[model samples]
Target: MISRKIILTFPQALLDKPIVYKLIKDYNLIFNILQAKITPDEEGIMILEIKGASRDYNAGISYLKNLGIDIRPLDQKIIWNERKCTHCGLCVDICPTQALSFKRPQMKIEFDKRKCIACELCLRICPVKAIEIQQ
Candidate 1:
């Protein structure tokens, strides 16, 4: 099995298509939508974590590329500024996936990028403005 987080950008012309559904039905892929902003007649952006057999996952990605969907790795979307962080633990408490947490004994905060879903919860709650979206 393979799991990866990706960002999908849908052009206006593909906004109403059932692209994600096809991934499941045709490719046997499982997807979890972490965040999305879709507006009629406008560009759509979504953060999704997809899991499936390695072959199926590769095929699904190829299908998406063939359809003109802009795909990017989710790791590039979120930025954590270590210098500005105060380690107040506010973001740790608000992160749903526990991507931000306090390290034991050291009491320093740690950010696990793989576990982050790009939900933006931490961005809103960080007192020192340490977390930001990279666009």
Candidate 2:
């Protein structure tokens, strides 16, 4: 199966449509939502990971673009700067994927980029602005 992380930006007019639903039903793709903020009559944005066959994945992406959904591949990275981090663990609570964890013994904050889904939670929760997403 092909898996890809994507950031989807939907216009206010498309807010009422079942876009993700169609991606599942018609395109046969599995979508996992990492973070989302969608409201009717307002622009909606979502960070999602989609898994499917190569052909289906391509088709699904095409369908979204055809509907005017702005699709951006999450190909960059999220990183933690140890120099800026205080090891306070504030970012740990907001990370749903447990990508940010407190290492035992030292109680130091450790970031596992492999486990990160780029949800951007740590970026907002870090008071010191140590967490960064390299776009």
Candidate 3:
């Protein structure tokens, strides 16, 4: 598996749209939205992790750039908030490959980002929208 990570800058307007989801589906590639940061100027910085063959990686990048995401590679840490997470277990159930899980006593969910296919099911199922995919 060839893995590539990219930091993208985009207009704030795109944030309101599910462009990332669309890109993932169109390319049939795997990705994880690590972080999303909003600037004072209303621009968005997104960190994304993608995995696939080399050709697929380049193709995915080209597709994203075509859609207007400024792509580059950088090192960054992504954080997930467990407090706002409802523990409804929607994310755990949605993982097709069982990449995420909920601990019984701790009542916390764990995400194995590498195992994620970037299906966006977790993001969609979180009723509170507590999970933020940052760049």
Candidate 4:
């Protein structure tokens, strides 16, 4: 039972209609939404806790990546700075796994380590390059 936390980033526009239920229905994995919030620029961010066999966990990540979702290991220590972010919402919009929410008026963001599959989208999309994956 090597459980781990995964962080996922998604577009805030999706929050107008959350796809989390669909993900649960499609993936058929037991998941809990630890944190959820939207950014002022309309980005949806969330943190998830996933538990299961290592094989199953990897399989789930593969499935999500195949679907074009952004997945990343949560063990990494990441820090966000508002000054660097341009509010372009690229990270929020491209997230396929619905792990990120930036739709809040304050542009608040949350991360769910369990749900992440380690796709590494945030690492690639962040313009200011604020997100980092630790381990």
State every prediction's TM-score relative to the real structure: 0.58, 0.59, 0.51, 0.47
Task: Evaluate model 2: give its lDDT.
Answer: 0.85
Candidate 4 lDDT, 1-135, residue by residue in tens: 556666666664445554556445555556777656554455555678876666666777777666555666555544445566666677666555656657578776655555454445565678788666654
For model 3, the stretches where C-alpha displacement exceeds 4 angstroms are: 75-135
Looking at candidate 4, what is the lDDT of residue 38? 57
TM-score of 3: 0.51
How much is 96 displaced in model 1, in angstroms?
Answer: 13
Question: Local error of candidate 1 at 6, Å?
Answer: 0.4
**Tens-digit lDDT track of model 1 for 36-92:** 765333677788999999999999999999999988886656788989998899888
> For model 4, what is the error of residue 4's alpha carbon versus the real structure, in angstroms, after optimal superposition?
1.6
Q: What are the per-residue Cα lDDT tens digits for candidate 3 across 66-104?
A: 878877675433344778877778767655545578877
Off by over 4 Å in 4: 12-19, 22-28, 78-135
Model 3 worst lDDT run, 10 consecutive residues: 72-81
Compute the lDDT of residue 19 as modeled in candidate 2. Answer: 89
lDDT of 2 at 68: 93
Clashes of 4: 38
TM-score-better candidate, 3 vs 4: 3
